[model samples]
Target chain A: MIETDWLWGLLGGLMIGGAAALYLLVNGRVMGASGIIGGLVDGSARDQWAERLAFLAGLVGVPALAVLLIGGAETHLSGNPAVLILGGLLVGLGTRMANGCTSGHGVCGISRLSLRGIVATVFYILVGGIVMVLARHVLGWI
Target chain B: MARSLFSALAGAIFGLGLLVSGMTDTTRVQGWLDVFGDWDPTLAFVMGGALIPMAIAWRVAARRRVAVLGNPLPLTHERVVDAKLVIGSSLFGAGWGLAGLCPGPALASLGWGGWGGLLFLLAMLVGMVAAPAAKARIDRITQAA
Candidate 1:
């Protein structure tokens, strides 16, 4: 099955868009992934904890479900887990410094025409682009 | 019992969605898009799973008179293209490439409670604290102009 992934990309964008609306409709909040994750750390917010747990479980679990039904495995994460850990830390710091994750700021924020989101997302893409360059071109990390 | 819960739930779901979509693994994402070697469709399913519900929700929100959370529906209105936008986007991209995960996926990775997730989570905290101060300064300058 060889074909273009445009349909998938469009579909994904729309789904994410729909999520933006739903988050607004239900929670009156932007579906900013970074902030939600941040809320889980310090406070004893139980709902936050439970939903976060469930959602992360679902994120990993759903793939498992898919594999169970469809017989495919998760993509191989090639980097050493140690490297992955270090990468995760840097990303977290970046997200916080920027005020939202790609989903929150890049997708929903820009969609809303938020200046902050617009600015932040631009930096996000560019920084990611640059890092990709360095990792692959310079350091060969990618 | 109250409205605040929706914020938390929605946020969590969004985070989870990021994880399932395999956006957490930067290499996988790039690999899926890459035409070089092995191609992965994991991101495709992840996107589909999210869109199916997302499309439904968008319509629901569009039809609703008031949000369940008692907040106004989301809207967009802006055209202020400035230096901040350029600088910020570049920073984000560089960081993402360096780490192979963004904020959402990084946090979801943390659910495993591994040391890597913890480091990402902590760095994110540092960024969060710094953002507000920067925002305020930018707003002030914008207001002045």
Candidate 2:
């Protein structure tokens, strides 16, 4: 089961990329999750509010429907309140500040060879690995 | 209406992809980040696979001035690497390592992720609202320095 996880990841990744392609080719917008939501929250997306809302609706709604039909998917997220709060805050602020997240910078940005996207991806991955080591092994916090 | 519908369809596919890719699983994400410990390379495969279509899309988009729906295609013009990109990405990385979830999975997992997920989402929203102010302060401080 563990050995075959990569296959699932690849298949799913293709779907994700395909989705990005569809959004780009059809709607002419970059399929960036954080940017989409951030624009709405910050009022910068006032002009495209409806479009963003529709995208979010499907993002949240489809999974919800899936849960209803095939049982809930397990997240295995940290149960610690502090971890959740702090992590969530960082994710929100950081993605907004950087102007992209994994999907945006990683999938979409790198594919296009965007320098900013590439740089952001490199920094986050490097920092993420460092944090994982510190938290998981040294501090045993998360 | 057609635009909105297509956007929804794209979102749906993206969400489904997250679920199918096991990206919604925090443990797996954490494992992938766990370089010094037990490492899972599944995420690398996912990234590689996703790059294929997106790279092709960029190529296709390059040849077309407008999208299929008549909207002008997004122009990638920004190229500067600044403090915001580095600092923000680092902070985001720390948070990701701590929680093992990013914006996409954070939202996608909500349907089944229960209270923990909801808490994270709310906190994230609060952070998003606060970001502009934070960015402004950072900019001010950087300029002062």
Candidate 3:
């Protein structure tokens, strides 16, 4: 199961990359989730709202359908409401402020060798690692 | 019409990839982050696999002025690393470490994550909506200094 997990992760990641490539090639848009969803409400990309909505529809609907077909997906999110809310807010604000996330900066940015994407990815990953150390090991707050 | 269809198709594939990659599992994400503890390196393969094709795609894109659909390509040229990028990424990283959720997996896992996922999504949307104001505030402070 462990080995298969790695194999599947690679395969799945390939699919994700393919999807992003297709979006860029066919639609000429960077396929960043936060950018897509956030732009809609923020009016930054208001003109392309249709394309964004359509993409989000597929993003949300397909996963739900897949779960129905393959049974429920697994998760390990905290049950604490406070934790969930705070985490959600941070993710939302931070992605918007940085103008990207793992998909934008981590995948697309690094792939294109864009300096901002690379720097953002490095900072986020490093900070994430540090937070994990503090929260999970040292302080045990999480 | 074609653009919307392609966008939707891409989103579907992306969602499926998230599921197949086991990224929908928070434990797996947390495991990857827990380098001091039982670190799961499966995510490395995921990033590696995704990068190969994406790098190729980017290379192809670098040569093209427009998309195959005749739309203008958005090539981000900004290279300035400033406070917003650093601060925002730091906050995002902290949040991700706290909850093991990012926008992609958070939305993808909605079906199974139940109420927690919904609440998180809502709160995230609120934060996203408020992001503009937050940016304005930051600008104000930066300018005032």
Best by DockQ: 2
DockQ of each: 0.29, 0.87, 0.80
Candidate 2's residue-wise lDDT over A1-142, tens digit each?
8888999999999999999999999999999999999999989889999888999999988988997899747898888999999999999999999999999999999999999999999989889889888998999987
lDDT of 1 by residue, B1-145 (tens): 3444444444444444454454655565655443333756655555444445545555566677467757676543345666445554555566566656666565444544345555655665665555545656766887899
Better of 1 and 2 by lDDT: 2
lDDT: worst 10-residue window of model 1 chain A: A71-80
Ranking by TM-score: 2, 3, 1
- Worst 10-residue lDDT window for candidate 3 chain A reads A70-79
Report the C-alpha lDDT of model 3 over B14-65, residue by residue, as the tens digit.
8889889988887888888888988998788888888888888877887896
DockQ of 1: 0.29
| TM-score (chain B only), all candidates | 0.66, 0.96, 0.93
Query: Best-fitting candidate, measured by lDDT?
Result: 2
In candidate 3 chain B, what residue range of length 10 has the lowest lDDT sum? B74-83
How good is the docking of model 3, by CAPRI class? medium
Q: Give the Cα error of residue B20 in candidate 3, in Å.
A: 0.5
lDDT of 2 by residue, B1-145 (tens): 9899999999999999999899999988999999888899989988998999999999999999799999899866589988888999998898898999999888888888899999998888888888899889889989999
Which candidate number has the best TM-score? 2
List per-prediction Cα lDDT, in the order shown. 0.55, 0.91, 0.86
